[model samples]
Target: MNDTSEKSSPRPRATILGGGPAGLMAAERLARLADVHVFDSMPSFGRKFLLAGKSGLNITHGEQLEAFLARFGEARTLLEPALRAFPPNAIRDWAEALGIETFEGSSGRIFPVAMKASPLLRAWLARLRESGVSFHARHEWQGWTEDGALRFGTPDGEATFTADVTVLALGGASWPRLGADGSWTPFLSARGVETAPFRPANCGFDIQWSEHLLDRFAGSPLKSISLSFCGRTVKGDFVVTKTGIEGSAVYALSAALRDSLEAGANTVLMLDLAPDRTLSQLASALSAPRGKTSLANHLRKKAGIDGVKAALLREIAGKALLDDPAKLAHAIKNLPLRLDRPRPIAEAISVAGGIALSELDESFMLKKCAGVFAAGEMLDWEAPTGGYLLSACLATGRAAGEGAARWLRRS
Candidate 1:
């Protein structure tokens, strides 16, 4: 029997590929009406998820869903319904229902009281078991069967699985060792799905610095600073990495800068050293300085500037700007930095490209291929970290699951 068809016979079998959050979410959603089997290439589910929990499992933040939905940019409309159906509040509520009560941190990001992703994942896995979802681990996907069945590379060699529908949540190219290595692109292309080239998003940019600046302040941090690019602004801390700058601020603007760099444009990342300080006030303060003291010492002692701020001023503006008080202060208010290139996509926390939206139906089902759906980071969209990744992953998983469920009914 053809796998995509909905023949009137036995219960439809739904196979969810990849065992990350999206795959798991799809399994849970499909189990209500269909026989579900989730397959993962890795030894276990949620390897990268557990790694994220290694720091602390930030599941979702407590911000309003509207603001959270806005984070997705162009993908917002496609993701809105699913997100609204199961939002941050619902996510926290669902977590509480799963025996893992959550709390909002100072940053408004929500996490389990235990503060690790593993415990919640374990609990969720146990729940999925009770919900009757099955898992097939260590089964690397090997594209289509000769008869158009789903084929996978198992430890024993190769095996073909038959299913009524298949949902590919195979994630993006980032964090490949943890399982989502983007090995499914060729398979999708073979099936006639248009794929965009995967690029770095939510990744750092490279900035070459002189040895004098590098050695003096390699790991220094610029705290409580505001950064801007292409009309978007974020207030956070950024660290001076060995290659360039990274951290929350840089990651927030990464998508814009990455796009600019990819287009061969000279991307200018502006930093406001004294975000809260007015140019006039800073000028007055700088002018009152110099009691035979070096400029660095005076700036540090007078303006509470240290670490990356001082290094940045020294590197970008030099001592001439410092000599002219008003100009130096204004420059501090509007310091410019050039971003030459983006870090490798492999090192990015998440990625920016995959199957384009034009290739998918309203149900997230592949337009050309019936009974096949794609979700999570595998879709062509990008958003920064801080729970946005996890939230959308869950939403799209549910969307695909519900779509598959409806398709099974029609079949």
Candidate 2:
């Protein structure tokens, strides 16, 4: 009477569609509980993740839990549980377990000690493989067959897969070449799963730039500045792109500016050229009698504004405001830059507005499609850069993976 229950029972099959952070994470979680398979449309996995780490992967933020969770904006409450379970410290520890140590930057953003994504990703994939997770590249998910089996368009032909649980981490429409093209929207919609329209997040905005400014400062960096929009102010630096403004500071305020523009409101990004100095102090300094000093020279000497910052003032304020000390000071303190529109979603760092939160259960399983879970940028949420995007993606991926495992166990 030897026990044969273990030999008689087979592990459940779990399929993860998409090989980005979320999909990989889901596969990792399900590896132990089920036969995990990760499928990606791209030829290889983690294209976007590798590119993101090209300049040193900022994996997560080193902020307090409250502050860290608040970065998700309106999706905070929905993502709180997942984030808490796999917070920044956990991210660092997990990376360490993968042989990739991490460090905190001056701004409290976390980065790998190796400063490259390839090493960490390599280790992660190896671990997943060791745990019996299989990888299928060049398999594009094409919704489901009539009988509810997963259908995929492969290079050879169409293929179908059946899984006890499915996790879709197909990401949002940003960096399309990196495999997150938001093509899964229509498929999910056909199944009655509500999704929000995709919009650019952490993206640059277009501005009507003068020829002079474009020629001189098209690729210049505006350092030590503060950008304000709709009463929210962020102190950081950004680059002056040929089309408009972008970088950390602009990305920080892009959500509000993009929303205001979309709402038909006149969106203006106010730049504090000299954030360290007070408005009254600037006014008093500019009021000094100029002994044949050039206006640009005066601004440079009195207010410490030069280079791209000075050119921005000239481009925006014109000569009328430049001559008056009070007006110049006010302009310096609050220089309004009218934005034309946001750069296309393809040019964005990430995307917002994915599967509506209401469509998913507490465990991240789709209420409409049982055993199907959504995670990562495919969910309706947006956050600034500085490690927030990756943090949320990994957390939600883990959550979806765990949820799928739990669902399989219950079934």
Poorest 10 consecutive residues by lDDT, candidate 2: 1-10
Off by over 4 Å in 2: 1-9
Model 2 scores what on Cα lDDT? Answer: 0.91
**Model 1: per-residue Cα lDDT over 1-411, one tens digit each:** 212323344777889999999988888889988878899999999988898787577888788777888888999878888888889999888888888888899998888889888878899899888887888898888799768888888778777788889999999999899999889999989988999989988898889988987888888888899999999989998988888988889999999898898899989999999898888888888888497998887787767677678878878988678788888888888888898799898888889889998898889899989999988999998888888898889889989999999898998
lDDT of 2 at 154: 81
| Candidate models: Cα lDDT each | 0.87, 0.91
lDDT of 2 at 17: 95
Could you tally the backbone clashes for each prediction?
A: 1, 0
Expressed as tens digits, the lDDT of each residue in 1-411 for candidate 2 is 111112223788889999999999889889989988898999999999999998799999998999988888789988999999999999999999999999999999999988999999999999999999889999899898888888888888888887888999999999899888999999999989899999999999999899999998999998899999988999989999999989999999999889999999988889999999999999999999988999889999999999989988988888788989999999999999999999999999998889999998989999999999989999999999999999999999999999999999899
Give the runs in model 1 whose Cα sits over 4 Å from its true position: 1-10
Clashes in predicted model 1: 1
